[model samples]
Target: MPLASDPIRALHSLLRSTLRITVTDGRIFLGAFVGTDKPMNILLTETEEFRLGPGENPNGRFVGQVMIPWKMITKIEAQESVVQTRNQLDRDVRAGYIM
Candidate 1:
């Protein structure tokens, strides 16, 4: 399918960006957003997993690439730079500024 819609294009623009994903098990993953499927399963590379359980290491461990099922995800956050860039672009667009 072609990525012709605005939302799809927006998502595409975030490709290779850093994302923080929290799972239902209270573990968080920080990785580069690589891909996603129709089921919303996310694929990430150079990932690190941080477990918040007792006795677990506060410093995240590198987990390499991972594919997270959408059902297990509780929250998703983009890196601050990505969010700020998008926000600024939105503001500029609203102000009739286009590049």
Candidate 2:
């Protein structure tokens, strides 16, 4: 059986969506997905940073637009709607729904 492909398309589908990204240093960033490069570096607009542990701020600091190195990222999360879309895409690919 062939493996499902189109990872690039899946990443593109995440554009313009709100994402919660966690980095290696235990900081979380919430931002609007804007851009990415061949290296997988991410660019986000209307960004905010939330630090964990002591001195945690209830309201995240406004960071405007920022570029996050892909290597620094530990995890990325999207809203339920985006997740559903991704899941559907996976199912469709597995079912040979897309050519």
Residues 55-94, model 2: lDDT tens digits: 6887889999999999999998889777687778777876
Model 1 Cα displacement at 27 (Å)?
Answer: 0.6
Q: After superposition, how far is residue 1 of candidate 1 from its true place, in Å?
A: 25
- Cα distance off (Å), candidate 2, residue 90: 8.5
User: Cα lDDT of model 2 overall?
Assistant: 0.85
Number of clashing residue pairs, candidate 1: 0
Instruction: Identify the leading candidate in terms of TM-score.
Output: 1
Clashing pairs in 2: none
Give all TM-scores, in the order shown: 0.79, 0.78
Candidate 2 off by > 4 Å: 1-4, 86-99
